[model samples]
Target: MKSLKLMALATLFSTGLHAQDRVKGFVYHDVNNNGRRDGKETGISKVAVSNGVQVTLTDEKGWYELPVGKDNGIFVIKPRGYKVPLNRDNLPKFYYLHKPQGSPATLEFKGVKPTGPLPESVDFALLPQQETDDYTALIFGDPQPYTARELEFFEKGIIREVAGIKGVAFGLSLGDLVGNDLNLHQPYIKAVKKIGLPWYNLIGNHDMNFDVKTDSLSDETYEANFGPANYAFNYGKVHYIILDDVLYPNPRSGKGYLGGFRKDQLDFVENDLKFVDKDKLVVLAFHIPLEHRNGDTFRSEDRQRLFDLLKDFPNTLSLSAHMHTQSQIFYGTAEGWRQEQPHHEYNAGTTSGDWYSGQLNEQGVPAATMRDGTPKGYAFIHFKGSQYVIDYKVAGKDKSYQIEVFHPKVVGHGKNTRAGIYANFFMGHQTNLVECRIDDGKWQKMTPVSAADPAYLAELHPWDTSEELLAGRRPTNATDSPHLWRTAIATDLPIGTHSIEVRAKDRYGRIHTQKSTYRIEKAKEL
Candidate 1:
């Protein structure tokens, strides 16, 4: 009888410990705009809440319970037609960090402070908004500024242009927010806040704690600024999943980092998707591109795991940034994708183009054009229902400027000139159709070829051939651009000025037209 009583007591103790580990919360409509859930306020049902892994919905009374650890962030997955509260800086305050012991003291940057104990109730307040299916999101990739001067360049060159810009629902930066300094995170936030939209950030390899011994502790500084590195939410018909795929102290070398996900992160994605509808469009945003020209930068197993989790969802898109250059990468059956439609990963162009390199423009800002000949630009992702389209916007230029047309200044009439016309469509893909027209003539098809951009070559030549010292830094050597197209133009026309127009039908079926001038002059007498 004594031994049986001891066993029962032990079981009760274990059960009590489990009960303490669970967190209960309420999702209520803050009608008055105050955070508290007043007695007059009603509860919002079916709202999703998560502890960075498992997701649960609120009950009829807006009550929810989820398991959490000592170091966990309890956040609400902001539902469509409802918005979360924003802090003074317009940063969304949707999460509550529960770190009893707080971050490790050895880190150079500050992290979250210790919360003595769990609150009696962790409640999330949300306000209602009329959301339309068709909306635009400003997407920026790698505004990575290494120094204060570069940060100023970002503020003047990029932020100043988009200040007070309207119509964008929100903005997302695809990692590499700053170069190695974690202290600049706040400054970066202060600068980007002028855009007047809730900005979401992704953790990159550069934005990590290098002193940590394990991969899981790599994002202490990031987590301190931004609640959780891995989280998801819904807006309109799209579900957005932001992940921290940078694995520090790479298992192979134990020195540098690797691009991959941890098992817990994979589990979190799998668990989160269980609550999502398969028909909804799933957009995964991360830092490092899954594959490069050489090969896959991330681990195969981790990618396969994510693929397995996403197999049921037919409509999916991934966004990444790490490579200084930009291109479109498709992964089909050969790459272990199970769906008939290949997975499209858009490697977005950087805002801090080529790390703020190249000669200064009239505005005294670095030209900073990317090595691929694509201008430093940001992308606008327009979504309607489950469908989406991307539009690349060149900074300090008109919206209609999509392609750069490069050709010889003058060609001899009735003489076979070796010069050819090239078009560098900013967001062109293999499926895009590029055509050129000269002097109001019929459109002729331009062949897509992997070659160095003639325009970028011209930009680089002046720096190398200049006798005197240049005013600003010189751009890096050009690489073969995937979106470049070439076609030999006929010089056998009448001697006069001719207008050459280049039109491109992009993968989304949208047509873009650009025009340039070329002179057809008579042959020079030798």
Candidate 2:
């Protein structure tokens, strides 16, 4: 009888511990913006809340309960027609970090301080806002500033142009907000706040705490500054899923990091999407591109699992940025896309192109052209209902300047030469049609070629051949440009300067045109 009583007591203790692991929260409206559930304030019904993996919706009373682990973040997904409050740095405050033991002391950077016990009620407050299906969002890829000086360049070269601008809803940086230095996170936040918009951020490989051994602990510093590394929010008619897809300490090699998602993140996505309307547009934002030229950079199984989870959604787009170069990739049935229309992934250009390398410009900033011949720039995504159109805005230039043409200033008249006219359409794709004409001559189709951009080569040549060292660091070596078009120049033209016009039809059926001049000099007597 004594042993039976001891066994029953032990079982009772284990059950009580399990009950303590669950947490409850309320999603309420803060009418006075004081961030408290006042007596008059009412709870919002049907609000979705998550505990990193599992998702649950609030009842009619705006109360929700979910099981929480030792290290997890509880967040409320901001639904449409409502807005989350922003902190002093303009970062959305929608998550509560729960770390019972805090971060390990071996970490190089600081992480979240320990929270002794779960709160009696962990509530989230949201304010009302007017949102519509038609809206615009500013997207920036990799504004990675390694040092204080480079951060200055970012502030002057990128932020100064769009500060306090009108007509945009909000903005987000893909990742690598600061280069390896965790200390620069504050400076980057201060600089980006100048834009006067609520900003969201992703945790890149560089943003991790490399001193940690496991991937789960790598984002300690990032989480300390930003909110949950994986979370979702609704804007207008679009559902944005921000993810930290970088797997640190490489699961395979146990040394470096790789591009992939963890099992818990995938579970969260799968559970979160269950409540989303199928007609809504789904946008996934992360740091590294799913498709890499160097071969199999992302884990194949993880991608397949993600695809399976997203198969039912017909309209979906993904954005990534670690490459610095810009390109549009399509994943068809061969790549496990289940929909008829292939999935589109935009590998956006970096604000810090080629790691802020190249010669100094008139503005005292590095030209910083990308290796794929794309200029350092940002993208504006305009969404109408379920459709979105992205426009790339090159810094220090007018918005209309979309194409860069390169050709010899003068060519021999009536003498066949190997010189070719090359046009680098910044947003061109393989399926897009590009044509060129000279002096109102017949329009000829330009062949798309995977080759180096001659214009970028011209920028890089001076650094190599100059007797004295250039002012700024040398640009990275050229790579094959995916959006470049070329056609042989006709040397049989008249002996005068001729105007050449190049027109490109983008994937969205929008036409962009640019013009240049080339002179045909009469061949001298031999």
Candidate 3:
């Protein structure tokens, strides 16, 4: 009889714990100098309450429920306008930041330093949601500044417009805060902080401090000041994922300047995917693009593994930077796996707007995209719950960007006969396409040539205004470097003269076109 009673008592205790499996918290807007949510203070209604994933509006009384893991469910999303208090590391004190911070010497992820009174009631104050016909997260590609003057170029060009975002909820940078100088992050962050919205930062190839040992280069301070380095947050209806694409301690260079991810972060991504609804959109963002440099640069082994994890999900948007121009393409069947197009990618342009090139606009901004004739801008994405649309918004320019086009330079009638077709878009990134058309026929795509190829890399314009480089961001030493642009040779050619025109288009429907005329005289008898 005693043993039975003990067993029964244990069962009841287990059930009780299960009953409280979730962490319970109440949200209140900070109103009238009071931290508590009072009765009808004209606040809290329509306020969004999220456990960091599924979001629900607060009831008339600011009542909300957050489902958290039995053990780690202490975090609540900090409402906009009112920010959570910062801890010693400047991290928000509330909203469940898992780890704790002991000392600056310690790693940043011991989890957040717990919370204050009102354990169950975590209130948030919002500045009233700003509604627009659309919303966007402007992505800047590699704004790799070789010097402080280049930083000025960044500010004078791209920063001016980004600093003045009107209806933007937030902006996300795809890494490369500096050109191999980790020291620049502080000033870079300060400059970008002027944007006024909650901007998320990512680590890039150039941002690494090579002097530090690989283990110590974990970017602890980055997470300390910028929150979780590998974290997912909900904004509007979309789930934004900012990943550390550049794995440090790279083997190729014996340094951390290249690309790839650590297994730990990849695993984190796997776990994060489980938190959201497959039907909803998943935006995968990183610095190195999946398809770059003649389709070689990407986090494939890991990316494919991740691609498999996300393939089952209904909709996904993958965004990247690193390459300093604009290029975009689709991938996968949106269902089963195809070996060919496993994933889609959109490489963003530099926010320094052509590395601060060209003359200044009226707003005191420089001509960032002066070379390709493209304007400095970030992407504009709009989401209605789950469904969404992406557009290109060139900063300072009144018009939204659409894809431009050029016809392939083909010598003959068949495949592989393509002579040459190069795209010269500057600071152009986003969901766009560099499609081509032959003799005004069906539009075809011109594959992005490599900036690594001696011929092409030489032509690729660097935004950094180094005095040594000549026209088009290339070095004036090209004539002697042996890497200067090489003459292109097309294998197949017909016996007649031909003319071709090509066109380019982005998701925003922006367009650019190019045409060339060539003659192929009858070949002499061999």
Candidate 4:
């Protein structure tokens, strides 16, 4: 009888039906926030938990069971009104990584160390917090500090200004936290900790283990630092899904990485959304922009699959930050969007702006102006119930400074010169109205043009033209600015200093104005 029982147990284990094949855990309310469940602490029912791909809910007793793979991260989908404990760096401690075999030993930067065996029960604790429908979140793109010096630059240039900033719920970095050097991850964390918010991060192409052979292992180091490459959380009425869309060792050319999603990730997304209410606004964030560049920078089939999965959700938004330039891309029927209203993807500007290039400023930080003329800055997304409006805050500048007007310092009087006045509306879309007038004159509509920002060109010109080497690295060449507006300057104005006012009405029905002065001079005899 004992031999027969052993054989049956072996068969069940092989088929993944035995009790040993599954892991049990409890999602409980930690009344004391001690990071563990005690006798008095009780489990929370109906909370969603996942083992990477499959999602399961806790029972009435708050106990849950999930089939575990050899390597998987079991995490609780952070629900609204509940807060997770944070580490010293303010990174949320929500998930438990179960890698019994651990990461490969050959990896250069090091990954998760070997975790010998699974515990009898893994418990996660949550604390309650008050969250309102109207709140603000700080969003940063590509604080890609390549060296320790550059990291300090980020600290003084960006973080120093917003440190201890109030009225913000949390902060998120869209990725490339460090350049290609994974060793700098800890320093980057230390630098950002000054902001004093529960910081969240996404894995960018630069934050990968390039030495790995397969894409599955590319995020070993990243996972060690930031828990999971893909996870979901909730704040008020918004459901945010953060993903690792970078596919290293491009499957086609076997070279650099590309932007796409794996089958398992898509499956996780599909399963995760089942628990989300259709009325809630879903926000997806990743490192690379889904919008194509050059020839299909991102995989089309994968994008279509994602779109199909999101077809049921009426309210959705996606955020990306790879190009270093800021632009708004809309996906309509042509891009396989299933809804009547097109989807919007905001390719945000980077905080590291042009890789920390250009001459040093008064603060001894790099000018780091973006290639599109959008200043190096961060964004504040104000959320109310499911809607949001984004405002860009330029570093070391007042919030009211939104438009950069480019015009000659002086122009010949009554000359029909081609000297045009250009306004680089950092947050303006092509559909937004941009008007310009001279000294309280009639407001004339400025035509939108897909051309380079002359202001950025002027900044770039000195490096090449200067006889001696400049103080800092040269900024990259300017690309055609998508949010630029142009109008001919009325040189016929009275011959004195005249204030040129440019007002831009943004997509959210907010108007921003900036003024520049130029003198109309009399013609000099040649």
Error of 3 at 285 (Å): 1.5
Model 2 agreement with the true structure over 1-526: per-residue lDDT tens digits: 9999887555334322223488898999999999778999999999999987778999999999988767778999999999999999899999998888887877778888887798999999999999999999999999999999999999889999999989999999999999999999989999999999999999888898999888988888898899789999999889999999999989989988888988778988998999899999999999998773343589878887888999999889999999989999999888877788999999999999889999877667899999989999899999999999999999899998889999999988998888899999998887789999999889999999999999999999998899997787899999999999999998897799999999999888899999999999988877
Which pairs clash in model 1? none
Q: What are the models' TM-scores? A: 0.93, 0.96, 0.59, 0.96
Candidate 1 lDDT for residue 254: 88
Q: Which stretches of candidate 4 lie over 4 Å from their true place?
A: 1-20
- lDDT value, candidate 4, whole model: 0.90
| Model 2 CA deviation exceeding 4 Å by range | 1-20, 292-295
lDDT of 1 at 43: 87
**Model 1: per-residue lDDT, tens digit, 262-351?**
877887798789888988899999999877334336888888888888899999999998877788888998887889999989899989
Q: What tens-digit string does per-residue lDDT give for candidate 4 at 1-526?
A: 9999998666445422343457799999999888989999999998989877778889999998987766778899888999989999999998988888899999999899887688899888989999999999999999999999999899999999999999999999999999989999999999889999999999999999999888878999998989889899999999999999999889878999889988778878998999999989899999999975533599888898999999999889999998999988889889988999899888888889999999988778999999999999999999998889999999889999999999999999998788899999998888999999999999999999999999999999999899998877889999999999999988887899999999999889999999999999996767
Write the residue-wise lDDT of candidate 3 on 441-493 in tens digits: 56665555433333223234342445564333322221111111112333345
**In model 2, how large is the Cα lDDT of residue 476?**
95
